[model samples]
Target chain A: MAEEKKRIQAYLEQLKNKVETQENYGGEITNEEARMDIRDCPECGAGRAYHKGLTACAYCGFVFMDTKLTDGVNIRKENNS
Target chain B: MSGNPLLEPIHGITLEDYGAACARLGSGLSEDDVAKALGVELPVWQEANLLWPERMKQDATFHIVTLFGQYFGQADQHPKFSGLKASASPEGAGNIEKIKQDKDFYQELEVARQVAYDYGLDGAQWIVDNYGIPIGDFQIAASLWNDQIHRDIQADYAGYNQRQAAYQAKYQQLFAEKQGGNVADDIEF
Candidate 1:
């Protein structure tokens, strides 16, 4: 278990360095973090995460890209199984 | 297969629009890749959609629904979709329609419906068969008639192989007739 922890730590460090050095940088610090942010709309507090590139909105019938992620407060712990 | 425009109405989108929609759906693919797969210039595709919207609409919708159902079943399961009417096929009755009434079916069919509209009969069937829908379900059968149509298309391939064998035998007979008394050492094509 200790050896596994050390290996994971080393791997994360490598990922950080790669992200910093890459010229055409994309994605945020971590997918997990970005996913948390995109789970709900940035403007209104709506919970629609997946966008279909359509004009009409399903909830509140809002017709804009203002939808935000909705479940950050209740984020379940990641089971590393 | 169902050429009834009234039953399977066009979405007022041209070939160009259809291509653009397909590109939008295939956001991860490169532009060149899209061109090779769709076989059309971006502008021409747009114009074709504007002109002959009916030509491919039924096929595209069918496909989009299939994709949506697949995506829904495996990845995302939307709870709100349960409220909407689930009947998308003519023969959908009792438990068949009940099965479709679930949110997964709605999501799946939405993806497949677009496919049917864009790729027409073949595309529609491709989505249905790839999704591996069970046979004898009416709503599944109705929304996915292209599956049957596709099987019909494959029948020609099976028929052709059988005919080719018969032709080969006939050719051998003709060769024997031409060289009835020829020695085993003499033969030509």
Candidate 2:
């Protein structure tokens, strides 16, 4: 009975260690690709999202993403899909 | 500290519910009204530009504690900024005595606990004023789950520390035997 108890205790300890190790080092699973797909630039259809202080067109260098619109306010598309 | 003796229990009324209440109460009234009424009633509101950052902080503290208690079951245990000292042995009778005697420990604990209560009361008041409930009817139920979590964690860490100390002592003895005399003198550059 004592030997059996010891064996069980050792097994439990091993399992605990394994769980702790996994928790400590196991990488976080994330949907980076899905996030990229969603946050893609609206105007250019290019995946480049340049949030550099200015919310403007990256490729065309258009201020506020438009020059014709004097207000310089970027209009968010209702459904930019 | 003791909450209002006349306070009644609020069933299922949450912090978000209180925020909605605050919003609704302030909705019909214009910014000018808020400035006027709150200025007379709570002068601090106008002085701070009606930027209730304090209210937001209070809400955030309550939310964090509620979440911690609900998920991990340590609601009563004081939430701390840093360090492992908070995770001490819950078993030792001396530990509580030490906490009582220690000024720093009491101060830290008081700050965390006070913030929790302040936010909780604000939330409760918001419900009463906005929900149009009867006086002393909204009962704020305080749970003990989070405190238990902190106690359990501290107990586990204490046990682990004991084991670690034993291991270190055994290693030291073995090293002293292997190197004869002072172990410190045996170190090679």
Candidate 3:
């Protein structure tokens, strides 16, 4: 019985020492690639501006930019008019 | 070695199971024949089953009401008649004469009424066979139709917005350079 108790005590001490000596490693933080996402309207801050080249907000009617939404793969063109 | 052919009991064989087995054995059988063999009730297919009779009724009623409303409005505009009545007075007499002359108008109304009734009764059999009901209610069907339309429009709008976003991102740099200066300040309204 004494030998069995001594064996258990030694195992427990080893486990405690191992746990105390263990170090926690964390993941590194990296910068995300910037992309155009929906942003709040600059004027009213209530409505969202989905695209960067929007002339005005759809909800608040706040003008965001002068660029006109033209046809083609390029959404906006210089509004010469 | 073949003396007597072994006979299996056919007591528990259902018609559907037999038909399936026959089909697997490459038996060329029509669907109706298969259904008949299985003792399954085949639904009566009809064109009327696809239409909503209530919708037709509503459409007819609306058209008739609008037509009458327009006629009354026109009659009201005349200075002679104060209200709708057939009398010896010039205004009333003239209105009655006009109505009597308009045989085409009365014929149109009769046609409309008949068409409405025919349309309402047309697909009744089909509805019974398909939906297990004689007629479907207009409001519920209309609500469902509108909901579907709304969802379709929303999905289309979402797709359009996604394409727009992709286009904007693709030419963001070019647009910024083209504007010469801050594009935000150049916007008037």
Candidate 4:
């Protein structure tokens, strides 16, 4: 049992230094790869935030990035609010 | 073999065993190491590894075995193996307390997962990098909320891997349009 704990600790330490994700599917999907617009609103300079369903500027009503909100695997409109 | 060899355990190694073996493989253990630990020859282990996924593809029911695979892969307490653990979920990977406080984050992760796959990216790893929620940990947490939903998620992985060739082709084409990437997507000026 002690040996198992030590091995787990060592393995986790190794993972902390290296993230071994699937490589055959190409590289990590950066925001540009997803075409995600995460820029602050040029109009009001407010950070982009996803609230209710819209992903626009929090303070100003600037819509930079938005997706069609639907009842998904976890996210639900009724329950979250 | 069992009633149906097609669905039977590979070389008498149960599906849970194969899942744990894979977890150990992901943990940087060599193929020979896993084969030895599992008390099988390297060639036999290799054959099982190859055929197991092929079986997943051929699984007519699709999700049943694979869902359990996902869970077993992360379950350190799984009965099949001792002193061998391959779960990649860090200590903070899935915090129940955090899940209770902000369910939105989890929901948003689900949404991100969908979008990443839509863009032909590996949805599991994408969420891991972006939200710090590994798929293994996600499986456990989501299972707590609802088992059926968790099954659907695992089933999607089986479907996705089969269709990944087509998806990767599209992603490569689309990604070529963009410049290089920054690991962290920062504000664009």
Candidate 5:
């Protein structure tokens, strides 16, 4: 029975290790949390808000992303050009 | 932790059935609504609702099986329930060709992808041996899934974090002021 208990403890430790070591694991809860969103231009310190007919930053003309925006259920097909 | 024993089915509602009913409750339906749907009286359903969660707290399998019951519950739905239903407009029906969106396939793919990512080639080899998905296809899906997840996080996280920060800061300030107002009556110095 004690051997089983030891094995279970080892398994629990393994589980704990697996969780704590994950890429997204945050050890502490805080008001200030890490984020991945790039809302501002790194080059010119300008807000990188969306602009119609443009994929780049409006202020600095910095290329934000290369993804092609497509017309959705609500957006018209004419906007795709 | 107090050890929880698995309770026998109350009013012919199996643990899987209870799990499914809990899933229904999770999606905004009330306990009474779930009980009516399960064709059982409220008090019996109430007892079941309490006991099942207690078991889940003790037995890890109970939680996992409950989650599985949430996803797989739709496929293996209880006899009393009328599972998923959808309505389509006639206008789109003629023009739009049907595309298959097999959720189970994607769920399984995700599981395999995570295994492959965590264990590298050995995990991919396991998928190849046990599951029938081609390695190339699995890799491609994993890449696509990662890109999508990254894009989704980028689109939403900052705004969500900002809102959360605002709420927390407000609450913390209030809490600090409240702490200051507390009377220290037990001073024996």
Candidate 6:
């Protein structure tokens, strides 16, 4: 029983030492600046739309695109079809 | 001014009665000026009448006449504006029917356009074809679609920030337990 307690104590001390030195293991993680695209309504000439492919103007009820804005991340491919 | 009906104290005066009283007074005002003067007094009388529960229904009748006259005047000045104004009148029952039919078509178009804007051209086309919505309506629909994606993305980002904060708190608690001092309190200069 005495040897078992000492073994557990030693393991705890090793974990404490590991935790203390763990700070140097990884570099600081920082948030990146977000990018945004803003555009104006063509019909009303007053309202602004943010995002690359917007469908309509909130003001004056103007529709900007016949197509829907892409869902999820938009990607372009080269060559093929 | 002694026998003037305009100045006479009456129990229940209406816009028409007031107009007649103004005419009897011989105020020498133009018809437009007389109407403009009565327009100012109409609301006051209506409001006072509204205070009496017995006259509430009469007040509603007065509102109907007032609104009709207001729109009629506008219709006389601008015939094109008369379409919307006429639809409000009982005489425009046919126009109301047409508007109802158009309203449904326009509503569907609006939804399809919104879907297209949210999903992209191919997505919008697929919806239009599958739904059998008129292609002509798509143009009108596109005009009404507003971008809500940025707002959704912003909301998602906020949630992410909240989750990040929770993770940070958990890390700090774990670090504090392992170390002698609270990890959050440890200042690095």
Query: Best-fitting candidate, measured by DockQ?
Result: 4
Model 6, TM vs. native? 0.15
For residues B20-54, write the lDDT of model 1, one tens digit per residue.
Answer: 33422332224444333344333333443343333
What TM-score would each prediction reach against the true structure? 0.18, 0.17, 0.14, 0.40, 0.29, 0.15
Docking class of predicted structure 4: incorrect
Lowest lDDT sum, 10 consecutive residues, model 4 chain B, at B176-185
For the second chain, the TM-scores of the candidates in order are 0.20, 0.18, 0.17, 0.49, 0.37, 0.18
Which ten-residue region of model 5 chain B has the weakest summed lDDT? B92-101
C-alpha lDDT (0 to 100) for residue B37 of candidate 3: 36
State the C-alpha RMSD over the true interface residues for candidate 3, after superposing those residues.
37.6
lDDT of each: 0.36, 0.32, 0.34, 0.53, 0.46, 0.37
Q: Give the Å shift of residue A62 in candidate 5.
A: 76
Winning candidate number (TM-score): 4
Q: Residues B22-125, candidate 5: write the lDDT tens digits.
A: 54453334666777766544544666666556656767666544443443234224564445212224532221111113333443444544544432224444
In model 3, what is chain B's TM-score?
Answer: 0.17
For model 3, name the residue pairs that clash. B48-B123
Model 3 misplaced stretches (Cα beyond 4 Å): A1-36, A49-53, A74-81, B1-189
Worst 10 residues of 3 chain B by lDDT: B43-52
lDDT, candidate 2, A1-81, per-residue tens? 675566557555654564444322113456665332233345665453534422344665433322111111132222111
Q: Over the stretch B60-137, how does candidate 6's per-residue lDDT look in tens digits?
A: 446534432333222223322212221123433333233234644444434444543332223334333444332322
Q: Over the stretch B1-189, how does candidate 4's per-residue lDDT look in tens digits? A: 257655555554567777767655544456777776766545456667777778778878776365556655354555544565444355443442354245444554555566555544567766655555545445444544455445655879676455444555544444323322222233367
Looking at model 5, residue A74 earns an lDDT score of: 32
DockQ of each two-chain model: 0.01, 0.02, 0.01, 0.02, 0.01, 0.01
- CAPRI level of candidate 6: incorrect
> lDDT of model 5 at residue A57?
64
For model 2 the local lDDT of residue B186 reads 35
